[model samples]
Target chain A: MNLPCIVTALPAESRPFFEHFKLQGRELNGLQLYSCERCLLLQTGVGKLAAASKMAALLQECPDITGVVNIGIAGADAPIGTQLVAGCVEDAGSGKRWFPHLPPLRALPDLKSVVVQTHDKPETQYKNGIAFDMEAAGIFSAARGKLDSSSVQCIKVVSDNHSSLVSAIDKSQVFNWMASCIPVVDIMIDLMADPIRDQVRQVDEFTESAAQKVHFTVTQLHQLHRMTTQHLTLCSSLPTLYGSDAKSILQRLKDELAATPLSYTNPMVKDA
Target chain B: MDTIYIEEQISEHPRTLAILKRYPKARLVSIDRYNEVFNNASQNFRKQKQNPALILAKKEGERVLPTPDQYHIGGQHNYYFSHMLNCIYDCRYCFLQGMYRSANYVVFVNYEDFFADIETITAQHKKPSWYFSGYDCDSLALEPITQFVEQCLDAFSEIPQAWLELRTKSTQIRPLLNREAIDNCVVAFSLSPEEIVQAEEHKTASLEKRINALQQLQAHGWKIGLRFDPLIQASEFERLYGRMFEQVLSAIDIEAVHSVSLGPFRLPRDFHKKMIKLYPDSKLLSAQLEYNGTHVSYPESTEKAMIDWCEATLLSRISSEQYFPCVSS
Candidate 1:
């Protein structure tokens, strides 16, 4: 699977991810890009618009990066340094909400699940029991537009709550809170990335080699691919291509497959 | 459902309140409308299916819709209504996975509106009409939670001219058994061979359980239906389905059966495409199927042969008058 790209709002929030993932700093398409073998971290300047723009551009440049993890610091009613995984992200201005596909609780047992209300500026005087952030909705909207909802996730560490004020928060404290969340953050990244890996279809080397031997149109290739998938699935192997011509071979394959009784064994069933 | 999304309009609705009381520990989120979450663009159906939340909203607009020409039992005028959007069971071949982008269940709590619409439609027809439930979801799957069937039975009792078909693969029949069997309601159960049930229909009642439920309902004097719709193909399908038919027919007094329907496994072109994407490794979706313009199904001759075999087998057990083969429009 392609490495999950981690999008953070500010450099302070990105620092823990950078050090943890050992991401090397580089400039990509005029945006601050950090990367390593495990993940890619993009530091979008604070706020929703910047996160959306930078994240969209990064995903556009790297189309293979299907999974996106938006991690940042947030103000909530919880104690400081508490990590949260967002069940829903709502734009306070537009009343728009995005529920990122939440994995099973057991997969994220350590982090509390909360609704994240995203605003234009940092939120203070937290109420309503929901976490407040500036960029979760933006990152989610952009990533979901590019990838599936299952591939997009946002996690935040509580930097300020009603007891503590936003202005009282410092970069060193933010870094410390994020550093504490690295274990759970790693789990979330793997949880998002694993599905993409499982979704990848096994490469059909035989089909590729067969296409090389015989020229096929674009439409023919699609048909051939589906036909080959069915043939392999039912018969467990493809019939030999005896004839030199593509039409004759295709016809022979189709004829043989039709006569084969449509039988299937469910993979989930044991002793099938 | 761990989290319940309640619309502000129906937050205080009696049904909504009852549901809230049932799931007391559920996280409640207030929404202006259901589509704000349900009809959103970026929702993923497969992932949501794993841990789906319930969206309790008042269904607005045209709640009653005319059934497709091919969908009916005996009545000339047929319609279908959905009190719930998604089913609890996940059959690999179900079209709901293709039709809706979200797997979250949306239960329209306004049962009075649906019954009112049904009443209006029946009155407009001025004749016996059929209103089929379970088109978009299994009729009795979440019976205890929704209590939809109890209210539906009461609604149908008031309108004797209208026929209510509660098609399901669920074994939740206690609610029906607790009340007197209404003549206008037919408690239909969707049956398949045990092999198919085990393989494809995930989280549904076993064939034995469904038969047991139907038999109890039949004994209670409720009209029961046998739905052999979406007939799947197998190498030894004749033997498998034949044995199943024997088992099912022998269990119930065939004379008590209200109707039996047969349909081939088929889906609209777009729905088939979407389903294939959701379950690429599914052998059922990967079968060497034929596409006839707008829908996909078994090869013409193969489908005809299977139907012929099933028809012949069923004919031996029941008369032709009770059979209904669903034909495509």
Candidate 2:
């Protein structure tokens, strides 16, 4: 997976996030960009078209995106400053929608879950029981294909609501709410980042290095993977397992696996 | 407080009507189907878990069916079903957490249908069939609102050939205590060391409260079973568990105890991946577990030691006939 990209609709939305993270180099199109070791942050000016355009460009540059995080102020039927994770994001213009399947990451303690409606223009009327935003649908549409929907997350801090008490809302306060939520958004990105994928990479590296010493056919390699089954122990104990050289460990495990009486019903198998 | 999502099909259901009445302030959202919202791809489980919504839907499929062979609790035809999808208590080691994509509770409001399905299954076999509740969710934690335990007891009373096991970690035993206990039903309490319960079983009743609930139920003529299932492994696990048994056995009536079951903490390889990423900081999930075929768990030696210690501790209080070791016995 590529480094995660945090996309915001406004400069204020991106300002806090951009400041919080240390980025290395950045590329600019219409929107400003900042990137670091394995992540990128972009300010997708405002509205749906800008969001889609900037997202498309970001994906083009980094094809293997871990996930996309959309953070901005939104209008909802909740208290102002309340943070929400988008459960279902809908494009108000075409009625097209996307639902990002999120596995349990167990982060974002105080934020609520809400269905977000992405409007092309500023939404004044929040009659429906959903939060209103300007960019999630566009971001989701582009990111869903590149990554799992569960990895694609959107963090919205409520700036206004249908029954908002204040006649005039403070702009700086809106920016501040989004700014204060940078930590939560970062945690969400980290939570959504696949840990298993990282473990798989370690496994792949160990397996590849081990295979380089001995010539194993495709069938033998498949059998080895089947025997190991990506167990966590094998991943952590890779260094110890392949002592001195890869050939000995490879030959030993392979011999052991071949000798094991395979059974369908029994889950108890000898770990390599 | 969280929002409540309702399937349009069951908006008029009696249980749905009763739940809405109980939680009137909860924001209500109507969806065409439960999956439309429940299965949404963009939802964050961690965020939703903070304020999990309540989904009321209709059960259309087979509501009662046999459980996996490994999940058998001494029955020839062991079957299980859920009136709910997710549980109220957020146990870190619970299989439900890994099984479902969503943490939001989905209660199928069709209780009568579940019972009717059970009737069909029981009639097919003359031998007593075991029906396990709380496999997908807890049987009595939300009893005050769901009333699932009460409803299931009513149904089990009629079917003498049916044995209902209401497994839970809840301290809610007033309903069972107030009523005449049925011979066919067993109110099983999931037991773990106080330290383990405190660490992994989030939002569940404390060990002391659960022990109280157990004693209360046993005194009221309700058959009780202790489930040390999904037993977690640690450095001093045996010492902690042996002490726990002494405290538990000393408090409750050992002769009245019906059965004790011990199981190891294990999860599907895929689910283990999902859970580890979900709670990376969790010591229980982060423990260097080995993948055994399709499932991941502590190494075989560690698993064996835990069961042996726990079985010895339990056997000291009760007879071998009264105890069942899931993996070993």
Candidate 3:
């Protein structure tokens, strides 16, 4: 679940990534998926509609993927080659808006933070400081129901600016820019992984295997999960249980905890 | 906070202007409404809690609401109002983590509206009406920045029948000490064992600091109250709580105390589920809990035993008339 999925609209934007990660590729129902041990990349084609459809399909295929990152080139008024992480993304066609929970940016000093606006057509007129892209909003919309806002993010490199029109840009230049920005992308992925790592699983492999051996009703299954979670957190280990069913196992766990009188508190101060 | 979100409608508000002046380096973003960020789905509450931002917006609609059935000190009619949405302190057992989607603090800048609502409600009642201020957020934690308690004291000074209780775990009492003590205002401090404070109440003042602040307020002629609600369970419950109570009671004059209340730790069913998912490793949440259909709390027998012990210990020090046991709703 800590593995972050990357979405790119064109192969030019993803070529350097696939080469850098040494990703192996496959075609799943006409969609391209490139993956490595650490990450997954999806080539979502060129527009909002196509990106949305393809990303939605990828999520359905991989439901456990917790993080989605849309990395590609964008047109902005700033200088070309300037990299930025989106603070807010809006769809120009529908006037819908979304704000991503920002990861701490102090550590990533090189990446500029900016607002992004997604458009249906190439933009000749650019707003001051806003990045214009074709795929961020689509990736966000498709992943909206499946992931948390913080887990879904967009990081864009400015390939075309006000002086240079997007139509004149070629794939080779896009690959060069993306290749140079790979380090920043790696940093972003690592930063995003920190929060996901903090999320602990209530049911570990041992607990899941134990439950399978017992005949637990849905309610009993939930109770067993809680009991085992408590046992792991407070007691530090799950002792041998001699119960025939879920009810008896749950009672034994409860009784063991009761005798101990739960009172362990981690001394670490995690609040800011 | 590194970022501050301001609603366009309240961009020019005087309070908002003053606050922005404090953090000139923070990145400011403009929005049409606070909910656009505060209510956004799929926000990781724990992640945002690490670096929470400040959202200043004008609160519209009903600003004052009735308090829960058991949330009262000594009033026939009781109500609670929140000028702020989230708290500065991160207590692991807090229900706020379950209640909110995003961890960003939302401060409603329309204090006059809340005061007007309080005045209106007080006029409708025959006797004095009680108003609780810290149910949703700490009344004094961010006092210097919000300046809310100062404004609230001024407003409550006008409506004598409206009793205002400023419950807090923060040691920010400079504002209260700077002004004359008001009889109608009770500065209530939520107390817990030092062990719990170190483990669970992450950013709050230590037990010793809270006692010092409470005693300072009492000496200034302010009527102080003690709140031990959501009494956390521990292996050495009697020794820890008994010592904490002794430390607090010995420091302050009992005659100046307004009231004392105690209640068990509990949360609505949905909130409990959400919190567990957020902090699966949390020992406080992982403790054996009794899940009735609608809420979760310590097992009934354990809850009863803890409450009975604490109540007896508290009643021994204070008069029965001064003690109020908050019933589970």
iRMSD of all candidate structures:
4.1, 11.8, 5.4
Clashing residue pairs in candidate 3 (N, C-alpha, C atoms within 3 angstroms): A148-B42, A149-B42
**Higher-scoring candidate on lDDT, 1 or 3:** 3
DockQ ranking of the models: 1, 3, 2
lDDT of 1 by residue, B189-221 (tens): 999988899888999998889999989999899
Checking candidate 2 for backbone clashes, the offending pairs are A2-A64, A99-B41, A99-B42, A100-B41, A100-B42, A101-A150, A101-B41, A101-B42
Model 2 stretches with alpha carbons more than 4 Å out: A1-31, A34-50, A59-87, A92-96, A99-127, A130-135, A144-272, B21-27, B40-48, B286-288
Candidate 3 residue-wise lDDT at A223: 71
Q: Candidate 3, residue A12: CA error in Å?
A: 2.7
- The model with the greater DockQ, 1 or 2, is 1
TM-score of chain B of each: 0.98, 0.97, 0.99
Candidate 1 lDDT for residue B179: 97
**What lDDT is reached at residue B253 by model 3?**
98
Q: Would candidate 3 be rated incorrect, acceptable, medium or high by CAPRI criteria?
A: acceptable
lDDT of each: 0.83, 0.75, 0.85
> B225, model 1: CA deviation in Å?
0.3
lDDT for B207 in candidate 2 is 78
lDDT per residue for candidate 3 within B1-329, as digits (tens), equals: 67788999999999999999998766677789999999987788898898788999999988889988888887999999999999999999999999999899999998999999999999999999999999889999988889999999999999999999999999999999999998899999999988888889999999889999998999998999999977998887887788889999989998669999998999998999999878877889888787877999888888999999999999889998899899664
Give a tens-digit lDDT track for model 3, residues A1-272: 34788888998999999889998998767767888888889988888999899999988888777688888888888888888878788898898888877766565556666778898887667676589999888988999878887778888888888788887789898999889878877866775664424324435565677877887788877776666666776777755666898778878877887776676343552221
The TM-score leader among the candidates is: 3
Judged by DockQ relative to the true structure, which candidate is superior, 2 or 3? 3
